[model samples]
Target: MTLKRIPYDKPVLFFGNIRDLFLQKVTLHEFMKSYYMRYNNSNHSICGLYVGRLPVYQVMDFNLTKDICNRDFDHFMDRVPLGMQSTDILADLLLLSPGPIWKPTRAMVSPAFSSGKLKAMDVVIQSCGEKMSQHLLKRENPDKEIEMKQLFGIFTLDVLTNCIFGIDSNPWKELNSELIAAFYDCENYSILTHLKMNAAYWFFPENLRRFLKVSVLADDSVYFAANIIRNAREYRLTNNQRRNDFLQLLIDNAAKEEVKKPENRLMDEKHILSQSILFILAGFKTTATLLKFVSYELAVNPEIQNTLRAEIKSVLEKHNNVLNYDTIQEMPYLEMVLLETLRKHPPIPRFDRCCIKDYKVRGIDLVIEKGTMVYFSIIGFHHDPRYFPNPEKFNPLRFQENRNPHGFFVFGSGPRNCIGQKFALIVAKYAMVYILKDFGFFSTNKTQVPVLGKNGNLDILIHPKM
Candidate 1:
């Protein structure tokens, strides 16, 4: 047997970019940015690299990147498989499932996040935000520095548990919450955990990894979440209970006839369970990270913060001092702040897709072969001075003029973009409005500045140097 390889003339990293990532020399995001700066040229739109023996193509040109993600989406419909489908329940997640499974599942889950559904879910989010603001207002030491990440984590968990599982979990009161413990455990961000994941990606063969049960999620966490979902589903069915939650939507929409049809697979119990878990996993950490970044920005940029607060107040006053879906959408400056925060500190800084069919470059002599991995650096485009001038400076005004730029991929682009984006925005916006209504974030001596972020399974872990 002979080895197969794509002919490449542009910059190539022979040993692949994984070496620096494994050595902690640079993060996944940083490596991509560095590669773009070093090898990106007007001649070629793509670069060549390897993850161990597997060949990978890094897209550098913005037009070509747009084509891959949007125009030529059918040729690259699915993401690079994680090779854990047989052993891990998480493999079935909408974020991980193959195109066959992803298409119908995405269609089924999409309605659950519709404008009407989000409007109904606004009450639940408002309740959670109210509780969080109340807790902050009651803080014994007003001058004491608050850990915004932890606070936002609690707020997001509370909202997700209530909306996704229909569990009224007051995370603020239950600091030692069992559900919280399971969530963090399932999405572990420790260096060792990431190392294990990289080992699986770079070294272990797919068959061997499955034989050894090299799972991405923790066993205990999976079991805990499974039990909770099963119990909630069973109780609702038995009692004929209906609630305004994602779980309820799934149950109601579950197919009753021709259930064995391939197209109806999303209605299966297993798929529904998988999607429920995914909603929590996707919504929890990312939304919290957005809140943390926004808070940090507001603390450091007091003038922008004040302008945002004024917008929030004006919107609320017009809407009878109510924080709901309609009122949230009315606050344009608040949206600008969130947009700038996402640009600077995107929770997921990079995205990948796998070529399903051989795709020839329109004007070049390159053909992306089937099963080849394609990578795009969102942070690179986000921070590019060409797209965002003075990218390092937090300027909400930049967004005020151009709300959606071609380079902006915070929620991603094209058909496979994030489905829960509107849901996440509503939750974050409500929390910001509720908190800023009474409290203002200000920097103190204890305040820490974010220098870099350590990549996690589902999001980036923002780390500050002491």
Candidate 2:
């Protein structure tokens, strides 16, 4: 209740905002954007609110957001803890692990996405994109209104499975493959499940929540995923096979860690399994969602689409019509279109960082205490007219002329940013180029002129309604 005393641009309402969010009165992004606008002109750039009893400070100023994420990253190095019990596989995720566990795991995983590693994985990505495009072309009614989310979901899942696990899921051929089934099960939650989770999140203490074993993922799906990884590892070792993929990279790292001292070992079986699952979950839906939006945007804006297609054509011609790492990098207009799409529809609406040390704002009297959750709304920043004029308009030219890195939180900012960003972009761009080169996207009767988005339960990314 003491958090209510903190200076706020609007009347301090302890439970009003959270109550609206829990009751589904307002989507999470809408709440954040409204708060951001309410506080944008205030002397202080931060506003206080309560998520249940937990006090959270929402950062509104772009400069302050930059400082917290980049300049003073050490003071806010870790995300707000999910508070899952130690035994849960989610506990060891690099996204949720504390500084000590996260640091070394990040170091090990970072190399897997390096320029060389990505170049090596380019073939796999291109193959998946080609399969998707071929499938689309083969469809009985090519111009029929196709649900792009499902289509891109298949492509992204195929790409992730191949590039991460070195397994050809062949999602194009078998839509209900075991891998796809498990992933869908993990994400599929019923209305009752959502109600239970909302109740627990708002009312249950961390210890009690963990005691109840309330997990965002289904237990059976987790077991199935774990078994898949274990099987893959055994098969690789038994066959003496080597692959240039994320799982193989982790397997090699784990092998190297065996000789290191216990304190020095960066990865083990649990680390590998958890990180592999995290990468799959993290990359799958977000990239699919990005591609879906990009496709939709191009469908509606044919001029921009044609311009982007011309660029893609020119770049691929220079690279001998091969959609490779270098080819993707040469398409600057593609980059701008992607950036504009991300600006309009950031997969993750809100992200947070926990204050590890009490820190005073440089220009304000407020001091955010250690352990307080600091929230950043990607919707607020991306849609702010001050930073992005006519934010609602789908114009890639904004990125071409005046782009502010600080205002962009699509991949997030600073050290704790999404590590798989490059890989995600590569996959998305390859798919776009491959499909656009052969087919043109045009809006249909079912196409939502201005796409609407809905927040999913426990989803870091927002899902669009086509």
Candidate 3:
């Protein structure tokens, strides 16, 4: 049962030979399509890979990705080397850790994301959505296109404040609040930070948590969060009242940690504080990127936008403009629109898993030696015409009709898939529902055409310019 190998072209594999690794601009979708066509047509089919200090492989096969991400996961379980372990705490979160540490942390964190908790947090998320609508209305001028990146960032910041910190940052305020200022600093990915990331994989792997020196907020941000978490925990304890927010759930669960691990440092003060910081930082930026991309897609495709708005109106009339768990769940068109956006622009483009032991992929008896990096190309698969027909077009019908059920893998798959997928979906949906009900998304001349991602150390995380 030997599987076919897709041959790699030497010329393209030598992709980054120039003086600039950060500025190498290649149209990724176009590049992948050509690679897929060549492999599909070739007699000796093989996957293409770019060999360098890092063996970056670009695979377009959905079957192979499932094998790497699920069936053959033992061989491919660790995220790619971001640099060193000592510097990147965001990466250090459950998404980036290995084996024993990851498994237990996952077990503990899983309960926090249950449907009950998501339901409880709905009001907090809905509050943010209400603010986002007002915020957008204030910015609207006929025919004026606002740079949505910053605006979406503010919207997501408000969402994260309520979700994670249980407070309102009002990031949409004319004068930036302290929370907004810290959030802005946290979002800026500088060259020095990039170098520290590379250092994480090369030097101090365990010590290079994302809370280190990625930005000034990485350190100072933690301090502010500690005080917040402390006050919240104390308030919850002092008053026998409970709220439906992320902070409360985490704190409540933190108290029961000793029951699970009597020998370990159960959810102590530092642990709770660190987890809070991780949630605020990781959740906001990634969700904001998704929301902005969705908005951009709507702006560019007015027809699809009109169709969706119609559905939103029809559904809201059915449920009286209140998007409850049942109502938001019923909007299939909205789901399809989001699916299309995710397929076209996945926030985290690539995922990696390090080989923990020798293993096989599909029927191929290859050496999955320890330390072998098995990378999953999320964008490559999402854009591949094999899974998605007419990949570039803003067609929501692909998801609306369940034409390609296994096509989308934006939030990832398997056990390690994003725990916050439900959280992200609800936030984006409510935000869209509120904004579209009031204002229509329009394109501006200042908007950058064919949005380009800045290529460098942080290439795995894609950010769009407004």
Candidate 4:
């Protein structure tokens, strides 16, 4: 057995070069390119890296990612959501739990997302999408420049609140509400806050993190988010009423009594709260981002947008002007456009796993030590030329053409990929279809044509959809 030292790329920081990427303030794709080029090894030479003194093994090769995330699932089974072990609800989240905690939790929670369950919720999602369209229409002033993300953000908030709380009211319609205030208070969207948060997540000492009990989310936000779940569950238990929504699923599956065993992790109230909050956090931002990018792409590519509108019209006619899960699924071009959007602008830029056992890198003689964190580069691969021809160019045809499906890592690859991917796609497509069916998104004077913003962020403008 030989332990060969992995190649290193000199980082320009006291801690390590990892934070340098954040400091440069580049898009996720650009940051990956900078390192991938600087390292400049077709082989896995630069796969192991130091981000601010943190040793992280980044898998750049597609096959290697498949090996680590899929073929060797048992060896690399944990995702570092917060920290591996914490008394906080972060530890109990379906996304964060690994191995002993993750396996059972996944099974218990899987039923909530079955095909039948999702179909039941689409009715509400459709209504929310309609509400979103109406909201846009009410504010349809061409002179007044509107940022699409804000509108999409409100839309996502409405949809998620309806699904999670089973309440038809628009949470965003009235910003003065205590819960809304709590959400905003918890989230500090300033660039500086983001940099600091990234640094803390990447470089701050674990002991200090635990000692200070530092959390990226604010306590008020957590309290408010948890309270929503509490009130809903209490009401459900008191009344014995069941609704066709995720909240109902959580209540039904959640343990009525306090949980005594590790296997029954989903039974506890804290667990319910964590899952509920995660649903809101996860569903809101990413889906909103997707809508923004998709709209921007459609606006820029008017021809494609027109084609899509026609297709949406045709599909609605086929369904007799009814919007549902089945109708959204029927539109292939819409699906293609969204898929391309994901490929070009992936919400989540990276995938990670914790090495549970000593595993040998296939095709290469390297042993990834246990307890090591491995990252699969979603951004790098998405922009890779080998997989996608003219990777920078926006082309939905790539999906229609016969290209390697493995190249696209938007939702990610293998068993641990996004559980809510189908549902997310369904909701995104529904909103997109409805928006395009009635309105046309073209470049406005305030429009930032590029998908990536000036500062490596998503900042686009819209003057009414038509």
By TM-score, who's the top model here? Answer: 2
Mind giving the per-residue lDDT tens digits that candidate 4 earns over 144-257? Answer: 655676667777777778876786657557746665566545555567766766676667766655543445566567777777778888988899877777777666665543
Please report, as a residue range, the 10-residue window in candidate 2 with the lowest summed lDDT.
Answer: 457-466
| TM-score (C-alpha, index-matched) for candidate 3 | 0.82
TM-score of each: 0.90, 0.92, 0.82, 0.89
lDDT of 4 at 440: 73
Rank order (by TM-score, best first): 2, 1, 4, 3
Clashes of each: 0, 0, 29, 4
Name the lDDT value of residue 328 in candidate 2.
86
Window of ten residues with lowest summed lDDT in model 1: 457-466
Better lDDT candidate (3, 4): 4
Candidate numbers, best lDDT first, in rank order: 2, 1, 4, 3
**Scored by Cα lDDT, where does model 1 land?**
0.77
lDDT of 4: 0.71
Each model's C-alpha lDDT?
0.77, 0.79, 0.63, 0.71
Give the Cα-based TM-score of candidate 1 against the true structure: 0.90
Which candidate ranks first by lDDT, i.e. highest? 2
What tens digits encode model 2's per-residue C-alpha lDDT throughout 1-466? 2364355533324343577777667877677778777776676677787677577888887899999999999999999876645435666889888887888889989998998988998888888988987787677755456677777889998999899999888889987677777776776777687667767765677777766646667767777888888899989999999998999989988888776766666677788888998899778878988888888888778799889988988988887887778768888889889889989888888899999999888887778888888999898888888788888899998877654555888878889999999888888888888878887777755676666563321111112211
**Regions more than 4 Å wrong, model 3:** 1-59, 81-92, 139-143, 199-227, 234-241, 454-466
**Candidate 2: clashing residue pairs, number:** 0
| lDDT (10s digit) by residue, model 3, range 254-354 | 66776776578445655566567777777777787777888777877878888888988899899877787678887889988987888887777665566
